[model samples]
Target: MSLGASDHRAIQPDNDDIESRIEAETLARMHKQLEDRRSFLQRTTSRRSSVCIYRVPPSLTEVSANTIAPEIVSIGPYHRDRDTVLKFENYKWSFLDYVLSFTRRNGNDLDKIIRSMSDLERSADATLISSADFVEMMILDSCFILGYMYLYTSQEDEPTFSIPIVTRDLLKLENQTPFFILEMMYDLMKTINGDSLELLALKFFNLKLPRRDEEILKSTYTPPYSDQSIQCVTLLQRSGIKIRRVKANSFREINFKKATLQIPSIAINDYTTTLFINCIALERCTPHIRTHFSAYIAFMSCLINSTRDVTLLGQDGIITSFSQDDQDILFLVGIQTVIVILKHIA
Candidate 1:
């Protein structure tokens, strides 16, 4: 209270020094943050130099690794040698032989098929495997898948190894052999009797147009494919709209116009969660490509919130759940969970 002018002058320098230090530190922190943001934007915006077949992020798999990961069979490089998946290796080899034999019967050379796949491996950026390894993987995986599809689709009654679970495993995001590989194999062996890869795939997965909506889909199936932005099926049906199943080759083909929503038929079962999550994962990894699967899932998830929402879709034959429980549909769709996963990966 009795301080002199000299004492006040002495304290002023210390206060000024403290303020200067605080300002310097704050500026440095802000500069660091700005640099960090710039680096992140650069990384995200740049095109990927190589194709990637990614492992499911731990944040996503932690909740249900079983849901995203392959169980009965493994495809691509991600889970090819895991003990759980390797047990099917013998079966894969057997199927490969069958596919090779079938190709030979169709007047296609087995050696030529291998050479074609080897050529593809050189051009494809999807995997980092050596050329020899890539060719081998492509041949083995592609043959196995085609052979399985053939057996399943054929009318002849053979020893049946075809199961619903296998179809689910084949559709898993991590479990896919590249589509190009399958297409090549199909071209090699296709005859008038043999189906294209797309048609075979539809058959193997059992995607069918519901009889009720077939006429409407055929009528509205024209150019200018419009996307239905409505999220939920119940909302569409409530607005006096009809959900018609279409003969689309891919799940990405969903369109809406006037009073009709045209979608490819999908059968939801125990494997639905795995199938959808994997498809969404593929869309997430490939940024340049159309987010067809992700958009479809988002639209479906928006339609599904609770059991009542699921029930409404079921009533219209828009959605058919394996279990009649609405909670199962909620858990399978995992709208909030997927949104978090997508954001995290983004």
Candidate 2:
């Protein structure tokens, strides 16, 4: 019952035709994907845009997923729907009510405020939310943040919200409302003149560390800028290098001169880890922005390999850990991991 040679030859051609068809389909799909990607890149890269916020890099997040996550409350679109974070929604609503009342009393129109924020949301590629949702989000999140800051700075009683946990959430990379939004809202609602949002937020986070005098505060840190970079704080200290707390306004302001590394004065607290890490994440993700923060973190990571490094910095007043435990301090910075990451990125 064996098939003849001609029959076998005929089947072979049919098999060949099917195989060829499958390969062609695969190639077509790949080609289409490439085209789509090219189109996307073209649109996104054609113009320069301000990216005041960003998602943490997946590679970095894989190392510590919770580092950029909002724990107690969600401020932005990324974590807006998590069950754990939704509990704060009620509080946000209440804050919004209070803010609206205050703004009205101060001669600010709620509709005009919403319209302004809506216009900004339309112009910026900040979120994927629809126009209506974006305006609602802006009003709610902005009001909540302003109210929270007001209560926090004024030392008013917060009956429902946990200020400490809320502070930590606010500093998380995924939980940010843009600084411009806050600035605009502040301009519209301020009862009196005050410091900028940056300074006010810094003050709220207790990051405005005291300096010795105006001279040191004004002095800039100029790094040696070389391919050769140190790996840890202990190593630097052991090599007769000194770390000084400079009274600068920004964490990105770091300088090295005559074996002394001057970094902006930053107080270590419960929120410090999230604050600094998110700042580093932002610097890493934004292309047009300076990498000063990333460079600083990379440099610090190189300098801090172990608990001994933490101990050295702590003694020098360059670092303070809320936990006071060396291991806890080390965990917060992930210095060894950061060094490896920066090496690969560089």
Identify the candidate with maximal TM-score.
2
* Tens digit of per-residue lDDT, candidate 1, span 145-174: 888888776755533676666777887767
Summed backbone clashes in each candidate are 1, 8
Model 1: weakest 10-residue lDDT segment is: 216-225
Per-prediction TM-score = 0.61, 0.67
- Kindly report the root-mean-square deviation of model 1 from the true structure over all alpha carbons: 12.9
- Cα deviation in Å at residue 179, candidate 1? 2.6
Superposed model 2: Cα runs more than 4 Å off? 1-52, 124-127, 155-162, 194-199, 206-225, 229-269, 312-318, 322-325, 331-336, 339-346
Model 2: lDDT to the true structure: 0.69
lDDT per residue (tens digit) for residues 1-346 in model 2? 8999998886775777889999999999999999999999887665323335578876667545666888878887888888888887888889887777767877888888888987878766754777788778877888888877776666544446455777778877778777777778878776453766665565465523433333332534535334475657766667788888886655657778998998765556656666667766776666566555556665666666777877777777777644556665654456336635765776
